[model samples]
Target: MDGLNRLPGFEILPPEAPMPMPAQDLSAAPRQVRRGTSSPPLMWLRRLLVIGGALLLTGVATAEMSLVLGLSRWSATGVVLTAIFALLSIWIALAFTSAVAGLPGLLRRSDPLRLGEQSPLPQTRTALLMPVYNEDVGQWSARLSAIRASLRAAGVVDGVDIFVLSDSTDAACRQMESDAVLALRARDGARVFYRHRSRNTGRKAGNIEEWVRRFGGSYAQFLILDADSLMEGRTILALIGGMERHADVGLIQTLPLLQGGRTLLARMQQFAGQVYGPLIAQGLAWWSGAEGNYWGHNAMIRTRAFAEAAGLPRLPGRKPFGGEILSHDFVEAALMRRAGWAIHMAPLLPGSYEQGPPSLPDLAVRDRRWCQGNLQHSAVIGAAGLHPMSRLHMLVGIAAYLSAPLWLGFLVLGLAVSFQAHFLRPEYFPATHALFPTWPIVDSERAIWVFGGTFLVLLAPKILALVAVALSTRRAFGGRMRLMVSGLVEILLSSLLSPVTMLTQARQCVDVLLGRDGGWTAQRREGEEIRLRDAFRIARGHLFLGLALTALAVAINPLLAAWMAPVLVGLVAAPWLIAWTASEEAGDRFRRWGLFLVPTEEAPSGVLLTSDTPGAGDDRAALVAAAMAG
Candidate 1:
């Protein structure tokens, strides 16, 4: 039972030592964490006083300006719109902040994640769902192989049912599914199975429904997995244990660290998520508690609860607002919560991991489908029977896609305001106010606040995430040096790719609104890159927006033009960023900067390798062999 016990659905690996790390000095792994006492009551009191005072001053000043400037006539409308904006902003801030704050609590409560634990799953059985469409079989197999090996090492490899739910309309993918299932087997009669439906009807949700309808009776719980995800067996066990401990919970979702991404863009995303994701996730989990929703993957759900709560509802018609819910996860989560079942997210499930999209275009293609789904959910927000938080989720889902249009509106409004102030001014010009008055940019002097606030919103999360990673894990991922260089590179790449990405996302939002689709596409393999030509073609999405911004900046001031150059250059070179981002060669070259997930052989000096389990470090060797043989 200690060394190699069976876990449901996982094949066993023979005992062999873990792969050895190159011998090197290892003094830096953090042995202690700073669990400082909560802020002094007086300190909090002072902060509250300062914050409240500022709010009071802001409200009074706004009133004074409106009254003296005779702008009070617009106050009623402004107040309503301002309240909406404030509420939306607060929701976002809470979702992210709560996710971050829950970490210390998580760190305090759970055992440090390690390898090799027996599942002791009791009598409960679990179904492992790997929902696949046109995804790369090799990539999916590799992740599952690692997960299975981890489970095998922990002992409890026999209590799980693994289903490869193929929604492949393509004949080749169907064959690929058959081949993959056949290749992954134990002496047990095909513990791994594949089923494809002729109707690939409602996309992912429909795919899941088919499984539930046919196989729901077999397992008490099911863990849904994205094709490109991996979870440590220990994490899986912890989730099952957590679920068993909490009877009213319908689902528990884990945020996986992004893995196997080769592009600079992908690494940045992965690093950002790893560094700050926990805090944001923790913050969300703390506030959300039992209202968290399923993300459709890397999550476990109670079968009966889901069946009762999340039956796919038909939309009124076809196209953007109809048929199946593209974003079924949030809606499903809301449904579970509305049904009075707790929907939770495990903020400390470290073994869980996923892959990031390698190229901008690829990500845009995926998001287009998501946009349609979310927009559709916008309507579901009004369903009278839904829980408040569930309705909030649908609202947020709609807002996320709509942000592009909002940003675009801000740009247009800024331009109109500028022209009015410069060419058609009619009073109202001390050239300074904290908030804009819908008039044209008064002398263009308020640029700093606008630029500064925008900058903070975009970059503060990265900084916060970085701080969280350093505070919590410190030397866990080797040393400060190993983590530092990796973080820096991730940030730089992310800044460069973001503008281009936003443009692509903007197009996707537009496309979804227009009722057109990019169609169902397959995910790429672990290391594949978009061709340079494709990258360039894709860059065209942002070029116009970028060039227009540049022209506007120049028209305003040469200084402004200079400041905005990166955005323009980025748009013009969108294809280059996409190509470089999607390229493994580029990723490998950057990895030398001590900035990312180095290939296994080229890991930097002084990296500390730990035994996954308490008893031994042998399972990794077995894992390598089994993975290769397959």
Candidate 2:
């Protein structure tokens, strides 16, 4: 018996046990040098073109509004509001234009190069690494078994190794994990291995780094998987092949689609990902080229490259914004890229799957952690030798969280300006030595046009995604009518949820700014019903904010109230909306009506089927079942 066998949950094979030989060294493997198509200047040119166009549109709109306000007086508040609007406009325009750029790629017959097939069965070993903390042992066992079965089916089981690197501290969970590993070994034999760490020093990144330092030398490549992640065997093989082919490519990230959703919130997110995720990903891939980002999991990395370049440096600051980078994936990608290794996004790749957070609360919790991590990137954005695109990725990530506060500020300023216009009297030609009295007037018609134009730009990506789906074979989402109806439902739900999310994100940003750390917490995977009282308690602030805003708007003017209606409505309905969306019953009911139906849900893939069914006569099934019972 080995030291590992002495652990409460561990079972190790005998020292004399025969194992499959590792793959040959590919360090001197001959490969053609392939440079990225989009150079930094060209990529920047494309970015600037879209941003400039947005600025032009915003400038025109702002000019029109200024003229309206200038008719009465040029208020400082007007200028400030225009600046905020410009920032928001530019942010959304970038997304809309990216979708526009991506539409053609999505419609193209051939997939992106990153997603394309490469040489089959490379003579190099790859490790499928799953880093888990306190997670459901049964689910983990089922997923691991399915992945092994998948590889076996693809005849690539011999080319890969599976590792469950546990950072779990709970004794019972560790024991359950150990038992599951033992059963899996009994059933599947030596290809799978398990190790539990007593101290999770650096958390997930630390867990992986420890593995790399210990066994990374044995593998040429490693595939990182989240606890909820699932990849088809063929997909894994393709990634390995790609790495073997592109020696300079350090990391390749696949767009993981959401599956196995059981709540209205989850289903809605699934539908969005299935329909809209591709467009956004396509656009990002198009622009990102070789400077793409890693999404933590459903990604492959060159073992040597990662080990050499991605040794994360501790930041020179206190908690929250500093210390070990919370969002390690992005920083790792940037570091790898900084070392001259290309990183790419494979959006067109299939068989990559990840489950969404089951409910609104679950999603918020995850977002909070991400918010902290992304904000931490602000410190790294200025690091030396980083590719400009890499910095942009970091900046964009930071902005994704920071935009919430900017939006809140914009709304508050707009309301303040509206109140000032309605309540305060205008000065007539006293301040300036002008003959004509400066009367403050708003060009209502022009303002309407500007508002409509902004809305159109904001909504264009969704419309484009819908059109792309419509143009394709409609069978996937149950034909054109259902697809269209589903799109509308998604839009409605997203719109209702936007205000609530905005406030939630705003709160998170404030918390981070206040030096509060979003400690690493395992996300809730399974859906649970939320009581009305619980929902109310969680969303009480939103309700109060809504009521207060509506009251103030009404007191200011009916027009103001009407303009603020959407925000007020969403905030006011937050409790019921959260409760309803969090309910699995509501999701199932909607599923019966064919609402929020995705193709994967309609016809699950073999990999998904295997993962979903853990008790199918395999020897490990009993172990998994017992673990679940425990």
Candidate 3:
């Protein structure tokens, strides 16, 4: 295709067009000579201390369990169970410790750098770039108009430009996008522009690189956003101001809150993010003062620094594990840091927002792609010259997916041990010639203590988040009773969904390991009713597993059945739970009851205006209608 045909919505300009040139000398770019006060050694020390402490506690618990098992008769199955239990214990403990560390930060609410009331208007030009792939063009135009209006209101429009770069493959979607772009241009003029690529080579990262090569020199910084992302002008100004003040800072990421949820699952996700996300993000920012990781969107990057250092090289080999890196944000951050530029996170910065998947199936689809991307990091983790912290970040990403399978294995092993204890004959006489008859024994009391401890660790973070909110922002989320009740509901629902998520992730991991590639696909953001038949088809494996376990537990012992009830219940009811939570009525009912309510949902910010709202620009409904008809 010709250049004009390749990019449907924009004209192919001559060489004389005001496009920026690439840097002639990369060494002239600002580079940090020394690490920030939160030095690598100190950061590692803190992380190791927390991890080491958790491991020590896990060791003690495992040793006590071993002794209890030894009281009756030591068995191989018991040893395996103890090991898995210890591993799981350490995982929970690490999270609990992070939350404990973050509680003070969240309660204090005094990150002056992030919460500064005033910042000088940025002098540098910044491009607000949004990459879309086969998305709803009408909705995209609405969101873009809202953001443009927000910037104009803040008087920051002079220094900002908005671009909608499309990698849409569907011809109808591309044509709709072209019509929407024309409408947006007619309303907003030169400040808004759009370009559609016929062949979206290398996906989003490539789309960004093409922009950088063509127009990167004209802008000092670029704010990358996803299709569902929304940001207030003030927050954008704050991010750019931070970059301007710190010459060596290459990127600054903000914590985005989930909003615009209309399904039960989405609302629950919004609530969890609002309540629990801060503590976790605060903890991360505490340790990763400068070497923070990027989350691909709602982030600003120095144009020159990114251009010089973050040109991603394709990995060797084929699909699934190699070729193009799907998760490029993390790698880019690491590369920028390695080239002596700092990456930071401003968790306290408000106004960054994004939408969540509407239901379990939608989330699972997105998660499958993420799972493959993260697993591919195993190859990148050992790349030469990467900072130790960067390696840790990659490892954590890998572990996040791997833990699902580990948990599943742990549960399966526990079931196996139970079966052996019930059905297999015990060897009373030792092969080494012991005279005394050995009895297989377990200390029920110690086992109870271990279980209680694990449960406490698992729930402590949520409790801490509740306490933090109550102490700091109680009025924002209604009264204490409402908050507590909502939390309880969230916990109950999460417990029900945890097994389903576990099975989904475990299956995805297994599929990736078996050489299956999760192709990049656009996520469905709008809520829709899920039929029972579809739900059952999606959750068939979970049902089969749950049924088999239930039968085995019944045959073994009623106590075993009781012990496995939570997992079994979730697996068996996965289909119903998915269908029910996906319904709009279910979500509306919860909202009416003030369950899982968020402050944003209660009162939306001014930046969230719809296209129909006055001052947001001309309506694009007719444009969308015309394009759809065509």
Residue range 39-64, candidate 2, lDDT tens digits:
23476676666556666766776676
Candidate 2: stretches off by over 4 Å: 1-8, 11-73, 109-114, 425-440, 615-630
What C-alpha lDDT, on a 0 to 100 scale, does residue 13 get in candidate 3?
22
Q: Which residue segments of model 1 deviate by more than 4 Å?
A: 1-100, 103-119, 186-190, 424-454, 476-478, 481-489, 525-527, 530-533, 597-630
lDDT of 3 by residue, 1-630 (tens): 112222444422212123332322222333445534322347667676666766777787778767766643355777676776776777777777778777787787646344355767779989999999988776777888788777777777588877788898887677666667656555645356567666777789888888887778788899998988989888888888877777778898889999988999999999999999998888777667678899999999999889877877777788788888898888888878877778887777889899999999999999998999899988777766677778878887888888899889988876666666665655433465432223346555566666777788899999999878877765666567788899989998999899999999999999999989989899899998999999999899999998988888777655557666889899999999999999989999998997888888677887775532432233447754543343
Model 1 CA RMSD to the hidden true structure, in angstroms = 11.5
* Pairs with steric clashes in candidate 3: 72-439, 72-441
Whole-model lDDT per candidate:
0.60, 0.79, 0.77
Query: TM-score of every model?
Result: 0.77, 0.90, 0.89
Task: Give the number of colliding residue pairs in candidate 3.
Answer: 2
Tell me how candidate 1 scores on lDDT: 0.60
